[model samples]
Target: MSGEPGARRRRLRELLVDTAPLRQSPAFAKLWTGTSIAQIGAQVTIVAVGLHVYELTHSTFAVSLVALWALGPMILAGFVGGALADVFDRRLVALVTAVAAWLSIGTMTVIAFLGVEATWPYYALAAINAASATIMGATRGAIIPRLLPTQLLPAAAALSGITMGAAITVGPAVAGVLVASVGVPWTYLLDAVLFTGAFLGILSLPRMRPDGERRSAGLGSVLESLRFLKRAPNVRATFVWDLIAMTLGTPRVVFPAAGALVLGGGPVTVGALTAAFAIGSLLSGLFSGPLGGVRRQGRAVTLAIAVFGACTALFGAVLLVTGLTDAPRDADTPLIPAIVLAGLALAGTGAADNVSAVFRTTILQAAAPDDVRGRMQGLFYVVVAGGPRVGDLIAGALATLLALWAPALIGGILILGIMLILLRTARGFQRYDAHAPTP
Candidate 1:
């Protein structure tokens, strides 16, 4: 009887997230720690930049254009940087890009300290910072497989989710408080200082050369990656499914309006909604033990995204209910029921999204040939970076034309339907085995 109890305890422990990757790999541990700290600072700057732009222009379009300006440069950097990682030393690429991104943050701090009122400078520097960060992200992703064995990749990805979830959960809230109290210059300066951790992390990594035939960094290399992806059905499915989920289900663009008009907690409600999603992600990563053993990675991605779409749709329903109710319009009015429902729904979205991300990342890292991993990762970065922007546009336009809730409701349904069709048709992806990676 005592042995049975111990067996049950062991089974329970097995169901929780494994931290073995962090425990086993010192290099990965340092990299994960440094990136986690720096990510929080980066989120601070991201929030501060939007607030600063809005204060200067008083035009949401101008603030939106800030992201627009960064998008093109970021996309270009992902491709070029990925190729560079394949052709040159990945550690050098990561280190140099990290330095450049850090310098951009420093420049932003200087501009803020000078109390520059020029919105153009903000836009220009933000573009540079975004481009540099994109390149750094691509390089770092390509280097991860080199740090750990194949069996632990999923665990590493789960750890990454924890880092991301913590950063996102805490960073923006801190930014809001700091920007409100300490002023924007200090907020920018904080990020610049904290970013030094990322530099240290990249510097700690040993030089990593391409494991197989190296591709020259340029348009031709980019084209070659595209050609390879064309034949790699399973890999193609991951990207397509991710793009679908992101484009359709992301609800962030409507958050401010929802807080003010429907939920009535205003800025607090907006922050709560965002934090709820991050909390979900954090918790999912915290208990991701069983996920590492999942062999049908493609099926897992599909199912997780389906759940994401459902949660988003549920969130839309909450908004719709709030709209129909006699909820007070005052910014301070507490729509506690609605707020709780919305938060829960968004939380569900976050959890599902993180699971899907873990599977997609593992599949990519495990399946792609080492020689082409950098290029593929670059394209992956581009998709990941670009999808949310497109989602924002879709949500914004639909919300403007229909209602705040309409975008989520409509988009969620679209995601579900499209994903189902893709899953039904893509037999190879449906049966993909992690142990026998195919791309």
Candidate 2:
């Protein structure tokens, strides 16, 4: 019986995220740690700033504009930023962008501390910070492949899963508490301080210049990357699957309507439903050891996405049942049982999506040529940033035209049908081996 306990502990260790990448490379370890810490602070600022805007203007439109202003610049940065990383030394690029982001944070901090009471300062600075962060993210993505060996790419990506999981889940909650307890000024200051970790990580790295045919950061470079994508079926498959899953299968669009019409509990229900997805991603990252061992990552991604679609459908079905029943749609009283089931389904989707991300990132970093890695990563940032926005429009339109539940139900079905077709037809993607990555 005592031996059995020890055996169970060993199994648990095997199931957790692999730490080999951290143990093997000191440089990679520091970079990952700094990036993780900085991202958490960045998330804190994001949430707190939204609340701050609301407090200042009492306008929800103003708060919406906060995201609206940043989104365009960030997407533009993704297009141009890759060219910068490919041409310049990545460490230098990261350091420069990190400084830009920090300066934006510092400026916001000062404005809030001085009781500026103005809205434009916040809007302009936040947009700058967002764009800077986008560029920094691209540079760092390009840098990671240079730091770690090809075999450990999946493990590195899994650790990134842990980073994102913490940043999105823990950071926003902390931001809310901090803004309520102290103030917006302090929250911005905290982000500024937290951002220094990125500097430490960037400083630890050696200069990393792109290895192959590099071009200046401009339209020509961006166009060349799109050309590369056309030639690389495996890399292209990653983007296609992600776009389909995110665009069609995202679950958040219906949360508000579902809460009011079917699920009940309104705002609290909405928050719980949102957090449940991040929580599932966090848990999966914590127990992702077996994920690091998969060689046929392309096949793994397909299966993970399939599960994602199924989970979305299940969530919709749960809502459909309550919508049909006599569940109180008061938007006040809680429906704990239905909420629990819905949360679980959303959590399943999050877990599956995170797994898909882990392998898709591995393929991107490992298969793409060194010279255009930054460009590829840049395009990756664009897809990640823009896919959800498009998804939002699609989801919103479907919900409006058909029903609140129809978008999720229909989107889930579409993802399943499309994924299966891709699985069978895109034989190259299914056969892609992590051992000898091909782009």
Candidate 3:
């Protein structure tokens, strides 16, 4: 109600995800476009790195080590990069990390072209690339709120959901074909070149120093951020609720078993289930215009999360029913109806999760102070990185001990119950206002 006339008007057509965010700010437009391309390129390298390492070592465990090596560095970078973002110009921090990632990609390309038989180099480079990317992402996230007015935060977050959805959905498929057709070397080279799009965006940005007190990049600054998160109920809500939802409801661990066991479609069934989630997220972004007008963002996030819980439960139920009333599945014939039903349920979960992401991201950027925002985003990236893995573990444990569908069934119900309770009791979060973000 407080924006410009055009924003206030919000034409009926605009209700279907208009391009107002892109049109309103050229800086944001460039950064968004560039980051979008960079994510696709990054995904390409992520997949290619796995394939390359596997080809060299011929061991899945070795391939797993590549990811494992990246994890430590990425976690460290969150705190360090955040502190750096708070101390130095964010533009500088982002640029440096982007270059580091690009350099690592370029090195991988050269090594691959030279037919390096050693696996250690690839492992080292992959870790560096992942860490640099984490830093870049954290710095970039902190920069978004500065680039756009508060009114446009929801729109920007929605666009980000679209960007991420497309990257994850399209990038892996392209990487598979590219690696198969050309080789790992070319894939690395392509990623290196594509990442220049990120540079273009970073280079275009002006010097962005911390707005308030400057903090040194160290343990104390990081601790300060942790303390801030503890005190800020709204901000804490974003992470706590997200962690609960992910830890309990991640159904991906059962995808393989579900496909081969009850579903009987094998890898194709697994692929379908995975793609359905991304498709749902994409669809939500495509129709995200209405979300921009929501003023009570905390409530919006709560409702979205609650819906996610229901969907997860529904997904589990679909699997449970299929497993119960199913005939002996042939390897050649999949239970098409069950697969469709399960995919739809997962899709619903994806959409609801994305809706929660949109509001939560908006809240983080809108509510958090500018000086330490980078570290906050870094912490967010850590959560983003680790939450799903924990969720997968929960799913795996439940499926191992009980039924393949048990994780979703039990986890979803838990999420629903906890969320409903929180909605009634967490008065501050329930009453949080978008116009005046508390966190």
Candidate 4:
């Protein structure tokens, strides 16, 4: 009986997410701590910005223009910032970009307090903030591989998942409360304060210069990274798979319509759906211990993404059922069964996406040479940021033409089919081994 208890404890330990990366690297620990905190503030600002825009224009389309205005600049900054990270001191680049982002937030706070009602200022400031953030993200992602041993890359990725989960989950909730109670200015001011934590973390890192020949930060360097990607089939496959997943499986664009027309919970339902997805992601990160031990990373990524598609499809089915059943559409009427089903399905998607992210990130860091890691990470950021925007467009257009659930259902099926084809044809990606990490 005593031996059985010991075995049970061992099993539990194996199931929990590994924390060795945090304990072993002081710099990483500090960086992770600061990023996690700052990300929450960032989320608050994101939500607050949207809310403020809506308040000014009383139009959802105008509010969405905020993201539209920021997207192009953010994507451009990602590539440029990534090239710069390879040429300059990565730590310095991150620090400077962090300060730029903080200033943008400060500007927003000032605008709010001064009662600046002009929409153009909000658009301009948001664009600056988004571009700065893209640069900082690209630089920081490249810095992680330097901070830890190659073997611990998966753990670092898992930790990042936890950070994202926490930030998305806590930040929006707090933002909603603050915006309702104190106001948008207070929310922006709080983000400005939290921004200091990120600045300190970057400041604490030692200077990190490129380990190989430096590339100039321009179109040529970006083109060079693309040429390298052409030869790196496995790394390229990671990007392709993620783009497929995000562009097809993402369903956030349908949430507002789902809540109002189908799910019958209005804003409360939308919040619950979003929270459920984040909660699942957080739980997956918490229990990601066995992920680091997985040797067939390519297979892991494929399987996880397949699961993601399946879950998204299930969510769509729930929506379809709710719409067909003539479920109550009023905000006051709760379609409990459909709502529960949709939430669970979305949660499953969150878990699957997090698992896929850990492997995809680990593969990128492990396979890419240090010389072009920043550039590769930069391209990764572009895909990460751009895919969702494209997905939003696809989902919105499809949902408008067919039904609220049509995009998710059709897109999920498309993701699964495409992934299968890729798996069958892309033997290089399928055979990729974490232990060897060949690109």
Leading candidate by lDDT: 4
lDDT (tens digit, per residue) of candidate 2 on 231-255: 9999999999999999998758789
List ranges where model 1 is wrong by over 4 Å: 1-12
TM-score of each: 0.96, 0.97, 0.94, 0.98
Question: What is the TM-score (0 to 1) of candidate 3?
Answer: 0.94
Best-to-worst order by lDDT is 4, 2, 1, 3
Global lDDT scores for all candidate models: 0.89, 0.90, 0.89, 0.91
Q: Please give the lDDT score at residue 208 for candidate 4.
A: 96
- Model 4 misplacement above 4 A: none
lDDT of 4 by residue, 175-244 (tens): 9999999999999999999988897679879999988975678899999989999999989989999999
Q: What's the TM for model 4?
A: 0.98
- Please name the candidate that would achieve the greatest TM-score relative to the true structure: 4
Q: Between candidates 1 and 4, which one is better according to TM-score?
A: 4
Cα RMSD (angstroms) for every candidate in the order listed = 1.6, 1.5, 3.6, 1.1
Q: Which stretches of candidate 3 lie over 4 Å from their true place?
A: 1-12
lDDT of 3 by residue, 1-439 (tens): 4676767566645767757779988888999999999999998888898888888888878887887888888889888888889889999999999989999999989989999989999989988998899999999989989989998999999999999889879988889899999988888888888889998788889899989975578889999999998898899889888998889889897987898888879878998998899999988988898998899898988889899999999999988888898476655679998999999999999999999999999999999999879988998888877788788788989999999989999999999988999899988998889988889
lDDT of 4 at 311: 89
